[model samples]
Target: MKQGARGSAEAGDRSPVAAVRVPAQPRAVDVDRERGIVSGAVRGEHTHSEQPLPRPRSAVQRSSVRGQILDALRTALVTGELRPGEVYSGPGLGERFGVSATPVREAMQQLALEGAVEVVPNRGFRVVERGTRELAELAEVRALIEVPVMLRLARSVPAERWAELWPLAEATVRAAASGCRATYAESDRAFHRALLALAGNEQLVQIAEDLHRRAQWPLVGRAAGRGRGRGELVADAAEHMALLEALIARDVDVVRVLVGEHFAGAV
Candidate 1:
C-alpha cells in the first residue's frame, strides 16, 4: 500500500475539483516581445495616448468662433470700447472678427440673455445703458449679499481651504498690475467667484456674478479717463490678499472691514 501511495503521489492524490487556476479574461495579443500587452496596457499607434479629449462635432465646429466673439465683445464692453446705448450689427461685428455673422448673432443673443445688451427690431443689438446710480446700487446689493456670506464662510471654512485660494488672489494682483481694466475685471470676478463658491449655494453664486458683471461694465464715461486708475486697482487687489489672510486667521472683524473697504470702491 505504501509503495503504491508514493507513485506520482502528489499529482495522483490531488482531485481535479481542488486544483487552483487563474480566472479567465480575454487575452491581449503581444505585438512584440517587449511585453506591455498582458493586461491594462494601452495599444493604438493611430490613436496615440497623448491625444486630447474628443468634443462633440457641434462644439468642435461652433464653440471656438462664437465663444471667442462673445468674450471679445464682453471685453470691449468692460473696457469702454463698446459704449452704452451704441448699436452694433452682427454682420458688422463679424467683419471685425473675420468670421461669418451667424456666430456673432449667436453670441449676441447670449449677451442679450445676460442683460448686457438688448435686441433692436431690425437694427441689431444695443448696449443696455446703465446710469451711475444703478451701478452704485448694484455694488451695494453685491456687498449686502456677499459680505454676510463671506463672513459666515470665514468662520466655518478651514484655513487650509483659504490657503488654497492664494493663487487665485495672486492672479488678481497680477491682473491689477497689468493696468488693463478689462483684464482686471475678469480676474476680480474670478476671485470673488472662488470665494463665494465655498458657500455651496449655486443660486447665490449666480446672482452675485450677474451683479458683478453688471458692475464691471463701465458706466457712461467710466472708461473715458473717469474709471478707476491702475493704482486704485493695485490697492484693491492688495485688499483681496489681505482679506484672504484675515480669513485664514479667522479674524472676522478684519474680514468685515476689508470687505467694506473693498466694495466701497467697486463702482
Candidate 2:
C-alpha cells in the first residue's frame, strides 16, 4: 500500500472471518452411563483459532514520507485530534493515514521523546496527559527561559531587524484576528524564534525550539473562535512595536518587562 493511504480491507470492514471455518468430527463418542447421553461428539468444534495480520513496515519507502507523517501528526497534535492519554494503534493509523506502519512507529517514538506521547509496557503508546495546571506551568517555564533571552536580544537587535521581524509578528496577530489559528500559531512561534536568533546563543535557541514544540501540543486555536478583535490585534502589534522601541533604545529592563508581560498575558 502507498504510504499515508488506507488499505482496502481496513477501509471497509464488512464481515467477520471466523464464521466460515470447518470443524472435524469425532471418530469415537463416549456415553455417560448415568445420563445415557453422548459426551464426546466432536473435540474439534471446541478448538480456538487466531489469525495475526502482517506487521506494517517499520521504515518509510520514500524519503518524503517521514516528513509527510510528521506534518499530519503535528496538525493532529495541535488540533487535539489526538488527546492526552489516548492510545493509538500504529498499524491502524498507518491504515487511516494511508501509509505503512513504519513511518507511524518512527514518528511515535520521536513524539514520545518530546513528551507528547508515553510508551506503555503492553498497551503501547498513549498521548501524554496535560492538565490546565500543566499548561500554566509550561507558561511559567517559557516565561522564565524565554523572557530573559528575548530581553537580552532585544537590547542588541538593530532597528532594521525590527522592520523585518515586525511583519511576522503583525501577521501572527492578524492571523489570530481572522481566526486562522494554525497560521497565527506558526507565525507567533516564528516571531519568537527570530527574536531569539538575535541573542546569538545557539543553545538558547535550541531550548526555545523544544519549548515551543511542546507548546504546540496543547494548541490554542478553537479558542480563536471566541475572536481576537481588531482592537486586540492592534494592541499586540503595539506590544511588538514597543519591544522594537526598547531595542532601539538598548533598554534591557524595558525589554524584559515587555517580554514577560507578553507571554504571561497570552495565558
Candidate topping lDDT: 1
Can you write out model 2's per-residue Cα lDDT over 88-187, one digit (the tens) per residue?
Answer: 6554455444454455667888888888888764334677866555566777888888876676566566778767776776776676677544455566
Root-mean-square deviation of Cα positions for candidate 2 versus the true structure, in angstroms: 14.5
Which candidate leads in TM-score?
1
Query: Model 2 TM-score?
Result: 0.67
* lDDT, residue 248, candidate 2: 70
lDDT of 2: 0.58
Which consecutive 10 residues in model 1 have the weakest lDDT in total? 47-56
Candidate 1 C-alpha lDDT tens digits along 105-198: 7898999999999987555678888777887798799999999999999899999999999998999999999998888999999999999999
RMSD of each: 23.8, 14.5
Candidate 2 colliding pairs:
3-99, 4-97, 4-98, 4-99, 5-98, 5-99, 6-98, 57-102, 58-102
Model 2, position 202, has a per-residue lDDT of 88
As for candidate 1, its clashing pairs are none
